[model samples]
Target chain A: MLEFDNTERTNLGELGEFGLISYLTKAVEINEPSTLKGIGDDAAVLDFSNKKTLISTDLLLEGIHFDLRYVPLKHLGYKAVQVNLSDIYAMNGTASQITFSIGLSSKFPLEAVEEIYQGALIACKKYNVDLIGGDTSASVQGLVISVTSIGFADEDQIAYRSGAQEGDLLCVSGDLGAAYVGLQLLEREKNIFLENPNIQPDLEGKDYIVERQLKPEARRDIVELLAKIGIKPNAMIDVSDGLASEIIHICEASDKGCKLYEDKIPLDSMTYETAREFGIDPTVCALNGGEDYELLFTIPQADYDKIKGSMDITVIGHITQASEGCQMISKSGKVYPITAQGWNAFKD
Target chain B: MLEFDNTERTNLGELGEFGLISYLTKAVEINEPSTLKGIGDDAAVLDFSNKKTLISTDLLLEGIHFDLRYVPLKHLGYKAVQVNLSDIYAMNGTASQITFSIGLSSKFPLEAVEEIYQGALIACKKYNVDLIGGDTSASVQGLVISVTSIGFADEDQIAYRSGAQEGDLLCVSGDLGAAYVGLQLLEREKNIFLENPNIQPDLEGKDYIVERQLKPEARRDIVELLAKIGIKPNAMIDVSDGLASEIIHICEASDKGCKLYEDKIPLDSMTYETAREFGIDPTVCALNGGEDYELLFTIPQADYDKIKGSMDITVIGHITQASEGCQMISKSGKVYPITAQGWNAFKD
Candidate 1:
């Protein structure tokens, strides 16, 4: 629970939907020239001129997606926006607006909702995305956040999942599996705190991993950087469901296969050390652990040299023909087929 | 509950998120030339060159917005799309595409989810809108549907709530209070069935009311009719959260007042009879009993003559100066002030 500046806790019921929305969005200012109308209307109006529009939506459920026991409301809010914005970036588009619809039970006070909105506002400010229209309803139980992000790009520049060529080079921006490792740490600490209420969490030097889980950043810079260098990816996907799963998605969609190297999979030193401590393989963590929010894209063999030595990018593998199947090449050169059976939100 | 078509059932868990989405959207055809990309991509790409883009979203919680005991899942799906499209129509825009995000519990079978998807597909087909992209995830409890509708219109054709002027004629498309009356009938029948499972629902004579409640249609035809007649509304809103609430919204936004006539309020004869049978005032139901998905607009008095004789429209009232306040004048010459509060989802 977050410490409230004011001890007077006002229930959400005190302010109905209209009052609550007005109160929270009172200070919201629309600066985008494209945005003709923002909140306070039946629908927001935007003029994208000749540019193509990009749209994506994500729904996050409480208990199913995040546990509020350790995850702060503000970070959850920020992470929610970041997660949705990542989808637009994956399409090589510029995110310009987002609508956040959150349903909460009676357990959340007005202050809590404000905290969540504040964090989301911070994210909108940082990304230069306008907070447009949204709906807030009463939840029967727990919190539910549904974010819809709107973006724009040229028709020729938009990346599709089925555009990868058979021999295209597969590259991923930023390291993988950090957020998944962070989740394990948070869950472990949450269990400890529940067992012994007096013991403080031992998160002394785990800021990097913890932040990765709590407030992951989308790789908008990677998209902009590639564009600046006149390189357009043939196929692209955001690593929201682990590197292996995303690569499989790209392969299946493009009617191709891929060879991801285990040694080439990017894993931070901290992630490796923590995985070893937990008696887990860092490679498996990178493979199965999701929510990395990095761009995993494929480019032509000729264009690979342009991005070869980028500090933030790692050349994980190359695409293969469909008959070859998606496989992972181990350090000892053993092959393993990739599967699409990951990130099951339904799996109890 | 809806009767299952077959004795055999496939659980939603069996297919997982990816398989379920793939199975459901396999037959989704994209006919819109503007739709560059559809369901399989991270984000849908749309080309709306030289047009203003419109966006609207709605979040509906299962228990609050619907009851599965009587409401068919397929109808729920269709109604969800209709409700969202109503907002876009209210803005005088043509809804082109929508993104549906539904979170459901394990209780729902794959067949049940398919039913809902089919209903939404039916609506999409009828409206000539494409189901571009969506997110399907597991819920901890009942169903949660969040739909974001995308639309486009010329700048001059777009309407806003804050454009009404004094002496503008207030009008409504279609009759009101039918949906609320339908709700009462369904609830009574639901209770009767719950008390004795052997007793079937008695919906023989209430076909119109039941359909109004279960499958409300947006006033897209009215919008087309108005466009054909070359009469542009000064201000407009969709009647979702009752007539009174919507009128209040228009009045507040436009900085104007209204004089709604009791006798002029369009209530179908069936709605009137049903409201009396339930010991509720038909006028009150029309005023405050929500979910009617009709268009409520204010047109300049000069344009009133052109729309006065339209069968689907009613000249309910006229806009007044702000100081006059929003009031409903009775047939017996009484006046009542309007307020902006209605539809408390959490209220028992």
Candidate 2:
């Protein structure tokens, strides 16, 4: 319903509330099986006959969660959805639908908001999740995006962070540290651009790291793959706050301790080399780098045989007695206590 | 756990993310039957058995949705949950749980955050809904609250906007214009307070309207009353954006026309006198002013006999053929086309 002219700036108010909502969601295709009713309702409705429903929410503020000067609106939108969906996948649930709300300042035009919607729709399509009802309002400050993702899983298939047994094998999906290194790259470029707008970012051969920071995907496939192999994780969580922080969550919740192998923590070659160039330890980057959006879960020792050779899975540690405490043993055979200094929600 | 003292400004950083979440929800007591899990996991788990689940999300920005100068943090938290619950009640469903996410600025001490949490927990307890999982992050700007309410209803009991027939009676619960008038009172007092701090708000007996503005309740009672009286609404919506706007939403969605009787519109004596005192039209206030949180629904005329003497429920309009158009007939017998210039989402 909103008509945005490519040649000039178009005010958001010119399109109004109904016009903007319709324009943003016009391309949203609802293919999720449980989505009985989507947009254009007081509340979206779903029918998940017998499965346990899972709900997760995330709020991404403009300046705090992301810097729009370096982060494109499209990437911000897509990453917001991925952030919430990753939570559901961490629960071993299928990411089914998302309701995305954005408060935009008048500083942005209709086209700018549309860019975010396009990216969000792309993530919804890629993850096979439907974009349900959400809201858009005029903000007094910069833009803010809030996404609530809904999913479901069979009662037995569902995983929790409080279920890890002493002998469960901790595993992580994909690599870590890349997203943090990529964020560092972007921040450097942003500073450079502010000093001189004509200088483009020197991001050659950094496509993988840049993509990790800009468009991280949720491990919905890993959730499905685990179920396909008939393995229910004893404990599970998404790798949003690095390997150490996430394991601390599982350990504290399950009332157990863990010994993570520092050498086994997954790190890409680019992440290692880039961290070295920046004078940061690659191991530290992997241990505490947030926003990877990968799945970190634990499977029973008996089920380890089933996923031993899985391509994206890496067994990093094993749960231990509570008295031992959560620690990481370095490749040099030195043990260190694991603490959650990775990402502090309270401290920017 | 984070401790809050009146004299000390406890930085949120003092208690890390896990500590903050644990401290805030330490008092949360879950009594909802559908809540299989709450707060600690990656996502909250729920089971709806054979019922259809409903979900609605709302983002309340600092300056956009509320003014902290006049709006107390406690009331802001309560009203945030109330707003989303109203959407569920409008759908003829019971709100069962809410996940409250807030991006709080460091300007707010840990005590201020706890006050918001206390108010939210109170709302959840009063509504018989569980406080499910949520996240608290640091914001560079002011506080932003995002509430996602989850509800459920039996297949046949759920109401939709597309069900109103030609002869359905449009009904509203409670009086209108009170909230808008109350807001006007607060704004006037705020201006006076800015001019001179010694003069306290002359709110005398205006407590009712002031409460309506600061703390609104969802029409859950109306939904319960209708079911108890064996009456189901043909179509329903919450009166958030004034009566005219809500009726227009119903008409546009149902593809029907409506004739609202101005004389039949319910208004409290205080609301009318207050609007007149401010040199504003009470009808205008009722028709265009927003944030009442009352339920507006259309019931088949056949069910009117059952609710003829219902408490708080007023039948103010009737549905008509699509060609008739949506109009309001004043007491003077003049018909005017209804418009929704109330509460524009894209405008301040």
Candidate 3:
């Protein structure tokens, strides 16, 4: 028998629905001047000035989006909020408030719900936003978490994939494909555990990649960083769906072409090595693997020097006129047109 | 075989997602100048001028919120949107935009999703709001629809349940008990069909009550009418949960007492008859059965003369001091304290 450390435990029923909500929203900080009221009312209050408020929603199902057998509930909740916020960030706005609609299954105890709330509250505090209001219901199947994030932006400051100019420099934030590689590693270990339950599956040296998959952060810093540098991206989209697919989207929406350099693609060391061990191409994984939650944007060539040296930014390619078409130049100098190998829940 | 008309057909595939969204939003008219933008973009843009924005969300799941054996999909879609807007109306604000998130079962063809959209679009138009952005994904179990609505109100104009004063007059809009009775009628027909599919649903002469259940409108008109009369409610809440339960909420929030009259509770003639046929107490159903989507509010006595003869207004009670406690005066002259009989999804 193995000793289990269960000393740190609490019951959710100790705090009823209202109490739990109050506890979670205690730390939310209002950064936007437009946020008139954060939490603790029938609804949140927002003053949008003369600017229009933007809102977007996304729902993540437990078994469908992640396997609880591998994901901790805390990380699941944190990642859910982050993913929704990424959409608002992609739209070039600062998230001000969110509504979380949850459908919880009976299999989950109330304690699990509180832990999820703890993580969500932490994210709200970190992002300086509020958990306004949402619906909670019963679902017979797996847990369903739907989050709607509201944001505000000056009309001219808003960015869209359709706005890329003909000769803009295409760039991305940090690295890509680590989360996908992390998923491959987790799946392999789960299989090994199934074969031998007594042995702790080997995951000794994969901290970076695993963390990327479990608790990815939205590039809120990137939004502020761009503003600081006085560079409004010609076009922008968050890389939730791998690098190549996102590039193609920019091309399609902007009616422009892109030529990317293989040598310029950024991949962490662990992601590259893990892809080899899994018998997959590192470049292909970087091009098609998703859930990185990084931003990809295009800035004019004149502004490149202002951002290229920044720690997390990368200049990967340049946008071309519409007639040129989109392609990638390989290390060996062969050009290949980009394709949308992005994740589609409908098809896969 | 009996001749049946199958000629009424609509193909959703012919109208792609964008086309369907456009077709439905075409009828939406925005009367409020604060609505900077509606639909068509990454999000519905709303500029609330000097007023702060209010937002709320709710989810209605099939087989949980409604039994499709009785409720039609179109009505379900319409209700999903209206319920969220009701939250805004409850806050004494005008709804500007709504985002709809839907989870579809694999068994449903694309047309079914479009039908739901058609209903939602019609509701948006009627409310003079915009359809912003939402997530669509597959559900392993059944259909689930979630809607988040945004509205605006001046800091001074925003009314909450916590703002009621002692001695204020309690008022309600339109009639009650109709939706509950309509539901009973639908359930009876559903039972008849299950016992024998050969029987047709004889739903004629029940239009008023049936429509109450299927397509209950948000009391936006009543909100406007109150504004016209310069009667700002001291406190307000929408009666989605029975009138008694909602009264209890107002009491608990405001820390006030109320004296309500059973005879003053409005009920339609058809609804009263249907409740008798179902062997359920009409008053009880009207007071405790859910989903009327009507406005319940309290106003200062000084403004009573301005609204006394208005067609849609019903003065039901008066607010008493907290020590007096919440009670209802029956038609038989007995008084009883109001208890919470609101729908509790968590209490399965």
Candidate 4:
């Protein structure tokens, strides 16, 4: 868990809105050639030329989306950018720019805000995306972050969720369930910390799961690798609301059903072992646990040969006729209908 | 003042996030030819072709930016879109698409959200812009709205705030200060209502100011008019932050000074009278009170004749050498330095 130092606190009111904005964004450097105008303007201007411009937005509310008690502000900032960029990459586009609007109460110090921006800047630098423009305002309660990511892709390179065809192989990048299990670990640590303030978080041996929860990366590499191998996914989506939920989305959009294999579902040993320790089924966690920023896509059967040998890619399912219904064939050879048990914000 | 009907309240939790989003966006129709793909996809794709893309975002927090006691949800939603689109118009670009992400607590009913979306749809239809994409999430507290507007303009036609020259004439579209004074009226009525719950609001003849405050429109017409007249602004900004603040921004960005005449400051009669009624200086209100959403721009002195006869356009001032400094010449011949006392969110 991250601990905030209160010794060097500077009130946000002292800088005012414009002063604070200028201070936070002073180091923003435009790296994209398409960015014609960035900060200090009414709007950011971009020259996409003949390429199609791609835009996606996500809203992260403090209590609903995250808990700052265990999550570091810098990690939160980085994760927010990753979550939005995942959408752009899911479209098979090159993520180029993002407008990050934030609303925070006066309870936060200037240094706290600086840490958030620092993390965002680091993510932007790594992803080669420009922080073009955004809005900042004081909120009445907890912090709210709204990120709108912009990208560009040729017409032929763009992939939509509705493009999936029957018999197409469903592939996912990286491993799943780690981020979800990581959150469970964080929540448990948070409860222990709240019960006893002096106890250090016992997250020493769970670095992989903890990092997956705190600083998840978007599958920009998966999009690039596909382009490099000359394989375009018929349908694509980022695994945000778990594999089951995202599969349902693709199926519903494409008017097709999917047959996912329980045995083929990739799970990290740490995630599986951690889930078992918590008395949770590892398969259920892999199916319903969300927040894995991996790319879940469907490629033609002909293209499977190119990705089969790749360690990062896993073929977990295949598209089926709509009449067949979405189902998961368990390791025991029992088939069960897939249901969207993913995280629901409105659930009490 | 707007009164929400609580007689028929449907809990937002019933719809969940996806259900709520689908319910709200069921009627969204794509009107922009540039928009290749809208909502339902990972990202909205827009084919801007050779035109440069203009992107701007604004975040509005419930308690910080508005008071729900007097501001209607529909009007609030409409004003939010107008506020973002004004930025695009400020750049002499045509707004064609917007991604509106909103975060609201469970206290809000489904109908209230529908009212907000209804208002947003009305604005989108009027502006000929597409509600391309967005994110919906449950907030821990009050409503949070973030709108990212996208537009397009030819490379040569786009106006930058740093393009102003010494000899350029400062021009403003539409009258000023009405919205600020209107807000004063609403606040007074709100306080009265809070103290005496049985009393009705005494806003008999304040329709103009009230409407200005509740539902201000972006000056898209002014941008179109300038284009029609074949005049391009050297520098431009929207008057979301009072005239003085916006003027200072233009001056600082262009590395020039400005001479704004006090008498030339456009003010509606209702705004002037209301300011006096509140025992406030109308000029100060025009200089400090914001949310006018009018376009403030600078054109070459030679292009003055084309706009001089237009009633909508007002020649308020002229650009000067950097050493002259940005100043306002009062009617009494006294010169005062322009200061940005505009709405600062950080101010307590």
Candidate 5:
């Protein structure tokens, strides 16, 4: 759990909405050439010229999407931005700008909001994205964050989820299930701490999993690497709702089926061991666990040689005709239809 | 007040996130040629060719930014889009697309959400804007709505708040203060109904004022009319935060001062009569009541004749040197410094 200083409790009402907006955005610097106007305007102006503009948005609410008791304000802000940017990257576009809006109750101090903006600015700088515009409001209850990310790409270079064809190789980047296992560890420690405040969290040698949950990164490197290697995926999407759910999305959008090989799925040793300790199958976690911001795409067979021998990219499945249906081939030589057990916000 | 059918409660959880997304977006149609790709993709794609892109966003929360007790779901959705589009129009741009995100608790039925979307689609159709992309999630408490609007304009035709000259004419579109007075009428009726359930709302002959509060319209016509008259505003902003606050923003951003004549301020007959009944000054309602969504702009004095006969546009004041400061000249020829009493979301 993160520690916050309660001594500095400055009420948000003192600044008012306009004063608070000015104070919070004073540190914002515009670096994107497309951004002609940033904050302190009725609207932000951009010049995308001939490139196709990509837009996506997400809304995250407290208690539903996160728990303030365990999640730090800075990490929450960083992760919120990363998740939105992941959508743009999934379209094979270069994210260049974002608009962030937040609604928080008066219970939060000025310093707490500052921390959130600090973390957001850090991520924006690292990714070379401009913080162009946003809206701020007071909520009646807990915190709320809404982000809209904007990106650009040449029309011919953009990849859509419906562009996949039969006989395409399904590829995934890095490993999965780490973020979900990390959450399980955090929840366990939270329960223990609630039962007895004196017992510290036993998170020794668990840094990798914990970090995965706290600060998941978007796969910008994968997009950049593909451009350098001259390989354009036929279809692409980010693994936000677990590998199984995202793969299903690709198949349905493209009107095709897929055969996912269970043995070929990449899993980090720590994620596997942690899931085992929690009495959960690692493969189930990999297939159903969400929040792993990895990239998943399909490449044509002719371009397979271009991505072969890459350590980060692994071929986990192959697309098939619609008649075959989407299936998962287990290591035991048994085939089962793939169903999405992805996280649903409405579920209790 | 609005009535909802409680007998048609369809649990939102029955349809998972993906299923819900598909069901909600099935009606979305792409009408803009610029929109290469719309819903069903990771991100919406648009090509604006050579025009500068304009973007703005707004966050609306229940019980704070709005009180759902008297707001109809349909009206709320319509007003949300208008308010965000007002920002783009304030920049003298033509709004083309929007991305809307919402969060609601499980207590809401699927039909309730459909009503909101119905209102949003109506607004989109009327404004000639496309609903490109969005995200929906279950909230832990009351409803939340966030909208991001996108538009386009030539670089030279765009108006920035910092471009006002010292001697520009201060002009405003349409009358103000009705929306504020309308809210008072609704609150009075709501209190009476809470104390005595059978008491009917006495809103007879008050349709004009009430509609102003529930369904405000953005001044897109003013932007187009200006282009037709061959007059470009030196600086412009929308009156979302009342007349006084918006003018103050213009003066501050341009590093100049303004003299607003109280006698020239536009006030509707219904708004004036209603404020008198409520035992409040009508001028205060116009100066600081907010939510007008009218356009406030400044143009060179040489173009005054071009707009003199237009009934909708009212010339209220003129820009002054920085040493003059922002002041209001009352009808009695008394001068007073203008202070911003605009609506603050953080205020209780």
Candidate 6:
């Protein structure tokens, strides 16, 4: 588990938009050879040769997807771009360009919009893509941001959840459940503030989890890292939903089953600590909490040695025969079938 | 002035989602040589052996961009896609794919989302592109749809708003004003509906104007028509915000002035008649009314013959030296400088 102190609580307003964007996307490494430009123009340029273009879009509304009283606009902007980019990345293609459509209430000053743009533009520059165009309008409620991303890859290079092999080795990127736990902390702090506006909420020693809630970066690098090691995931998906939910997608699509090791799960130290404080099982948070933005994938075991010692790589499970059913092995040697506890926007 | 009667109303629920989309995008003609497929796949394909990729996006919220009290969802969906595609078309590039991100309210059902997609898919087929991917979420208010379009053109073939040459002939494709008049008619009918909910709308003779309002098509054909005639516009933009507004964009981008002939402005006969009935000047509607989705461009006069006698071509203006100032010449030989009365979502 990774651990960090939450002593630094910078006011997002001080960074401005451009500064925030530059600060956050400063480490994104572009790996796709087809990416003509990653993040700095009216649009990202791509050279797909003769393949068909692929584009996808998504919209995240404030108060609906998040609560602004707890979430920062800069992180919100970053997550918005990450969520859309995940779709493209899931298709095993690199996003070349993106368009941002933003809706702000009259109550929000222009500075708020600028801060959002800062996060967006920073993601663009880090991904090496351009901010081509989008629409802006007024909303009666909270802020709404929609981003559409474009990506390209050869037909053969694309991987879908439908193509996993029964014998494939299932793998996942980085840690899980941090973002959800981060949200928990933010919500807790907000409650404290609501109880008394003058209270400086106790966010001490919770920086990692809080950052996870505020600005979770997409695993664009994992895709590249795997490619660099000459490994192509048979079936891959970004973990926008919980790990169990996404695993079910792979199973349903590939018509296969899986067994995961509970003790082998990756959990950042702060996330585990907070989950314990909240009286929730850390494993449950790891399994049910969403928005990790990690990449879950399967690969042939023949190449397992190549990825084993790598940073943040966890071998939590293995794919089983279809009839085996999806199950997880508990640390106490208990076997439990996974159930869908997905976050459904429709279930008000 | 073109002339027509005003008594037509159509309920969108009649066609549902699939039916409405099929009805509107039935006539889109693909002209770009690099287009691999149009509007039927997870993503549109583009043969990019000789060109660079460009993409853009936009989001339109009901009540903000259009009043559902007047505008139907079918048309709203169609226009949503058209507007994004128009951005690519404005750059003298051919759109190859689109991604739609929709935020639907609980008031809407699954059928409504399909209806919106139907409109989007119809445009995809018409424009010879693909519906790549998109995200859907619940909204707290009315519907909001965001669309991102991907396009391509040779590096040199790409046209920007800044490329208008002095003395170039300013040209417009298709007729205008009908959409604006149609909007006015719909507003009146909406008022009547609010006054008496049981009285069925009196709609019979306003098919042309209503179609203009309910199912406005983008001028994709013009892109092909000009290509077939071997003419690339020196500068181009889709007339979304009315002629006066679009012309101003050209003037500002090109750092040049423009002259327009009021006598040459094209207006549908139905639109002109409706304007008179409403006691509004037909030309004013043409200049200030938006959502025409037509191409307003400038080409060197050397290619004037290429555009002359072309179907739906209008020689409404010419590019002038910067010192000449931007103004329009009326039939009585009076000059009135153009002002951007087009919509500004930010203004109070």
Query: How well does candidate 6 score on lDDT at residue A139?
Result: 68
* Residue-wise C-alpha lDDT for candidate 2, range A1-348, written one tens digit per residue: 112356867788788877888888888898998999999989999999989999999888877788877787788788999999999999998989999999888767888888889889999999999999888888776788999999999999889999999999989999999999999999998888889988888899999999999999999889888889999999999988888889999999999999999999989999999999999999888888888999888888999889988989999999999999999999999999998777776764
For model 6, give the RMSD to the true fold: 7.1
Deviation in Å, model 2, residue A212 alpha carbon: 0.5
Candidate 4 has a TM-score of 0.99
Higher-TM-score candidate of 2 and 5: 5
**Cα lDDT computed for each candidate against the true fold:** 0.90, 0.89, 0.80, 0.93, 0.91, 0.75
Chain B TM, per prediction: 0.98, 0.97, 0.90, 0.99, 0.98, 0.85
Output the number of the lDDT-best candidate: 4
Q: Please state the error at residue B332 of candidate 1 in Å.
A: 0.3
Candidate with top DockQ is 4
lDDT (10s digit) by residue, model 4, range A22-48? 999998999899999898899999999
Regarding TM-score, does 5 or 6 come out ahead? 5
Question: Which has the higher DockQ value, candidate number 1 or candidate number 5?
Answer: 5
Q: Higher TM-score: candidate 2 or 6?
A: 2
Which residue window of length 10 is worst by lDDT in model 6 chain B? B1-10
The candidate, 1 or 3, that scores higher on lDDT is: 1
The deviation in Å at residue B235 for candidate 5 is 0.7
lDDT of 2 by residue, B39-98 (tens): 889999999999999999988898777888888778888999999999999999999999
Question: Which lDDT tens digits does candidate 5 get at residues A244-291?
Answer: 999999999999999999999999999999999999999998899988
Q: How does residue A243 of candidate 2 score in lDDT? A: 80
Per residue, candidate 4 scores C-alpha lDDT tens digits across B295-333 of 999999999999989999999999999999999999999
Instruction: List the candidate numbers ranked by DockQ, top first.
Output: 4, 5, 1, 2, 3, 6
User: What tens-digit string does per-residue lDDT give for candidate 6 at A4-100?
Assistant: 2244445444443333444544544455566654443223456667654557667888767878776667777787887777766776777776667
Candidate 2, what DockQ? 0.73
